[model samples]
Target: MTPQRRVTLADIAAACGLSKATVSMVLRDNPQVHPNTRARVRAELDRQGYVYHRGAASLRRAGAVNAVALVVNDLANPFFAEFAAGVDAALAEAGHVLLLGSTGESVERQHAVLASLVEHDPAALILSPAEHSSAARLRRVLGARLPVLLFNRRLDGDGPGDWDYLALDNRAGARLATEHLLARGHRAIAFFGGHRDSSSCSERREGYRDALAAAGITPDPAWLIECAPTRQEAARQTPALFVRDPAPTAAVCYNDAVALGLMAGLAACGRRAGADFAVVGFDDIAESAFATPALTTIATEPRARGLQAARLVLARLRGELPASPHTTIAPVALQVRASTAAAPDSPLQSSVQARGPAA
Candidate 1:
């Protein structure tokens, strides 16, 4: 038995007794085609089992497709999940689909994901780069064609390139968290979690240090604890903050995950979080609000940030923006909760007392 011949547009047009051009226009939903003619074309198409070759159509139309690529470091993290959800919501409203890729914080994995996504001819790319990612390396994989919007992490040699960037106000947010702790009379505060090499972590640490210096209190060298920005690692490393002579009374955590982990670790060590040790965290993930004693955090609003990132890409794609690269630093706000309090016998108590009840 031989395979049947595949039905073509010409076959459909012949059956409908209409010109191939007219049938093609109807198939594409072109406004030029009459409603009655479109109905007839559709009837003929259905009768002949005509399958629309979207890939072929996209190729013929110069690679125009309703899809965009979004690559992030860790999707399992609720922060990125919320961000991706926001991106998806915006894209869906704009009649576009999001092609997602998770790099798991590996530069090599990012290369592979981008290579695969490019084959699908995505209209644009939104990338949350892994730590130590370089501009030259990204350029090699992405080529010079597709528009890329960098999210959160910036490339090492980014310079003034023709790419858009959307990032949280990491330094300012961390400063807000640190300052909140200071306001509650915490002087010997530790900067907790996140690797020192990461750009976000580095900025957060700078903010922590800045807040301490502004209070005329130098942070102890041993108090700058470095760990993976993960709950498990933070929990394991929490004990180190209390190893030294002058133990820290508070901690400015890298993110909510670290803060929550530290809280759990404190429990294991027979120390209560809000009462015994004041804690403040950056990126108020959903779990932050429901944690034991609730978390005092800087809310970056990951989901809303994701929506803005998508809109930025859409604007660029529609040529609504200038040719020059754009950068947007989203603002953050502090959410004071039960997780912070004045230190026991704190030196700053005098300053708080002088300011009266408002302080």
Candidate 2:
């Protein structure tokens, strides 16, 4: 008996009852090949263990990995989860996939994630950086090396580089929340937040103060609380505000998580968010709408932001447009639910003192 020979292109073509030229075209990914024929050719290639040298290389060069890294400060955060879901939707629509990694709010961990992603050599990366990293360090290291699109958080001094960015106009959004509370006759408004060093947090705080200054209300140095980034921590520290001699009538939270936590803390002290004190949150996460008394919040357009960021990274990868170093969306409408209503009977008048805490 004749010994079996190694499978070749011709062998695949013969086995599939197709011509050598057709097989060759299929291997080359020539678009002229009919879909059925291409599929048949690929099937046969797999069966025969046939490898197309140039075709594989071309696929790699063209980003056939169809991957982009999504690095976030914390994956456990609901806001990030929503943002990641949006990113996944956009990527799926575009025939791509996302590689997710969480930094857990650590610069060293962020560095490690980026480094690990580099090993995969993804087409691009979307990042919400940890607070400790400097723009210069980011630029010096990851900026020049790959196309990075900043999402959610903006680093200080990163104007426009080869990278891209899409961020919320946090300052303007915070102002809207603050002014809304002020309009409801809540003069003593407090700002509760995460890290002060975070650009988004600082910008929100700035907006809060700007609104007060514009309204001729003196900024209270005691009104701002730099609390923890998590919901539990926000709950732990929020009671301090209630204990103050003149508790703020309304509080602007960093995000829905903090807002809900603050509400919990207030409840523990016999105060309710919508019934005893007004509360406004940012990010407008889905749960914010479901929270007891439903939260009033500044909508950040997370899905749109994620889609835009994906587009920016794809465009940069394709060399279609110059990297837009910075991009921001203005605050749109505020979602005023029971949490923000001054009273159940009136839409315009909020029940400041009756603000009920989240259940």
Candidate 3:
């Protein structure tokens, strides 16, 4: 028979002629163990090639996001994919890994995901909340213990005291889109998609109204559609708006996804996006630039937001800074594309010849 393995914790204990418990205590760096005993155990451990497990060290060091749980509203959206990639890169640099979960825009789903994440005992959590998440529900799952950072979206009517938030300047981005439409001589413009209670949607709506009011135009409430944040829902809603009497000459969409869906819907109605109707979208997603006619959009840096979130988590974990309860990232700028050009000065005119193609 092959010789038994020579070096185990038992072997070390035998060589030192000490009890297994004494050896364990020494190896574990228990202060109760005498210094001489610890020195002897260290010498034996070195001689025997003994290695201690790191699991205890990890648990001791965990603050929030030592192992991070990244919760998002939708995984299908490319915006979330790119943002998660950025979060991964940042987390890797900090020696932490991200665990991602999607809520599918359901409050019950959000609750389930949140509950599952809590059970895993992550060091920290980052959430891009769904529309109907409640503070009471979140607190019940976490029990006021683990640190959580809300990203991209906020809890409705939430005060600053309960949580930390990192998000984009959605209102300003909306203002940019609306202002761009206004600059291009669009008077009858409409806001599209997104639910009522979402802070992001509400801010965007506020900005839309602000721009309209600034330009001496009253918003037509009938044109504002609080549709679901999905392509199919946006597609379903678009034709109804287009078919209405006194249809809007231009529409400002919630995001690139909504804009793309609206275009699809317009196609079904035998309407061309840029040629027949002007549309402006937000988020400046990669596909938005390559879409047919291209998309005129307000740009916010999602990757930058992800990186900032990672830094926030790591900083809190390392105790390098106090937990910031509120953080807001501003929008970058508007990118004008082929979409959302003026239809014509007069409604009866078929087309207005451009002086030159948009650069």
What's the lDDT for all of these models?
A: 0.88, 0.78, 0.79
| Tens-digit lDDT string for candidate 3 (1-359) | 96756466677889999887888788657899889989998998998787654344456554333578898877778888777877888998988878889998888998888888777777788888888788777788777877777887778557664677787788888888888777666788889998867888988899899999999999877879878877788888897676567889889998888898998888889888877888888888889989887888888767777888878877766666665565756556788887776655644234332222332
lDDT string for model 2 (133-183, tens) is: 768876654646677877767776665544566778888889988888876
Misplaced by over 4 Å in model 2 are 1-24, 27-65, 140-143, 156-162, 323-326, 341-359
Model 2 global lDDT (CA atoms, 0 to 1): 0.78
TM-score of each: 0.91, 0.84, 0.82
Please tell me which predicted candidate would have the highest TM-score against the true structure: 1
Model 3 misplacement above 4 A: 1-56, 59-65, 346-359
The superposed Cα distance between candidate 3 and the true structure at residue 223, in angstroms, equals: 1.4
For each candidate, how many residue pairs have backbone atoms clashing (under 3 Å)? Answer: 0, 17, 3
1-359 in candidate 1: lDDT tens per residue? 85998888889989989888898898878998889989999998999999876677788896458799999988899999999999999999998899999999889998999999998989999999988898998999999989999998778887775689998899998888888878777789999999888778988889888888899988889999999888999999989999997799999999999999999999999998888898889889999989887888899999999999999999999989888998899999988877886776765544321212215
Ranking by TM-score: 1, 2, 3
Minimum summed lDDT over a 10-residue window in model 2 is located at 350-359
Error of 2 at 7 (Å): 10
